[model samples]
Target: MSTAHAYYPSAPMPITMPQKPGYYPTPAHHGYGRVSVSPPQAESVTTSGGASYEPSATSSSYAGSASEYDSSGTNTGVDLLDYMGDRLHGAFDPVPLDRSLAKQAQTSGELNAKHRELLELQALAQRRLAGARANFADGMRAAKEVQKDLQWTQKRVDALNERAARKYPAEYKSAQNRYPAPVDY
Candidate 1:
């Protein structure tokens, strides 16, 4: 702004940032003292967006700091326009790539390859399922037939043992004494 229209006061106005919870800047760390123009009051203001804050000090009373400020109210130090235009230039330039992002990208690429392998395995399983089912069915039928024949032969051996025990007791008892049945079946 031109000198005539500039809102920049001769004395720097208290910089008021939005108040944050659990954080209050003291003069020691922030390097700026607090200013209150009038007696402290229980007052607050709400913005249009519904944020509430303590009002800025109004009117005029600087406590015992009257001698510290220039009574004449004149310009001091560098111009605001020059400081903003020149010194604040490089703050908005693009930042370099962060290392964490590179690591994340590498892990994501590896996971993608693993996911592709799993997809291929799923497809192979789908392709071979019909042939595998057919082979299993054939094997099942053969196993059942062999099991049935084995059961039939076992029943015949048991029946023969029962007949020999009843019809030829004398000889059967002698045979039993010499060699006992291998199994009850």
Candidate 2:
């Protein structure tokens, strides 16, 4: 079975008072400078018949304290260990090569000569490649321009043909009429 309650229609609703000033004071020694801490009050749940219910005080304080205290903890021994671990692991190891292998490597004079030769060859190849590429690009561009010019010339010839037909229709007709179709043998 369930029970239900109803409030009187004419009754005045309850009112809550304004919060107190300086309710939260800063801790002087912490050096964080004037941080306010206000504990949240437990809300009163009121039934329709004016029956008020409050949650447990201990439970309410726990929520507030959890939020307030949640932060990065101070640099402890574990932190120091982690930092030392990172520093040690992050460092690059010194590479050791065989002295005999190094001695067997190419001589400095020979290396310098080869390097110079390589540089000279690279420079010559670069110049030739650049010249070839430039020539190719220029040729392509010129071909495009020539194609455009030929199209323009064709357009001009067509215009001229149309103008000649309008201005000298008789001559135009005569020229077309004179050119007879050849009979295939």
lDDT of each: 0.54, 0.54
Question: What TM-score fits each model?
Answer: 0.37, 0.31
In model 1, which regions exceed 4 Å deviation?
1-89, 92-95, 98-104, 122-140, 162-167, 182-185
- Which 10-residue window in model 2 sums to the lowest lDDT? 8-17
Quote the lDDT for 54 in model 1. 31
Worst 10 residues of 1 by lDDT: 1-10
- Model 2 residue 18 distance off true place after TM-score fit, in angstroms: 99
Write down the lDDT that model 2 would get. Answer: 0.54
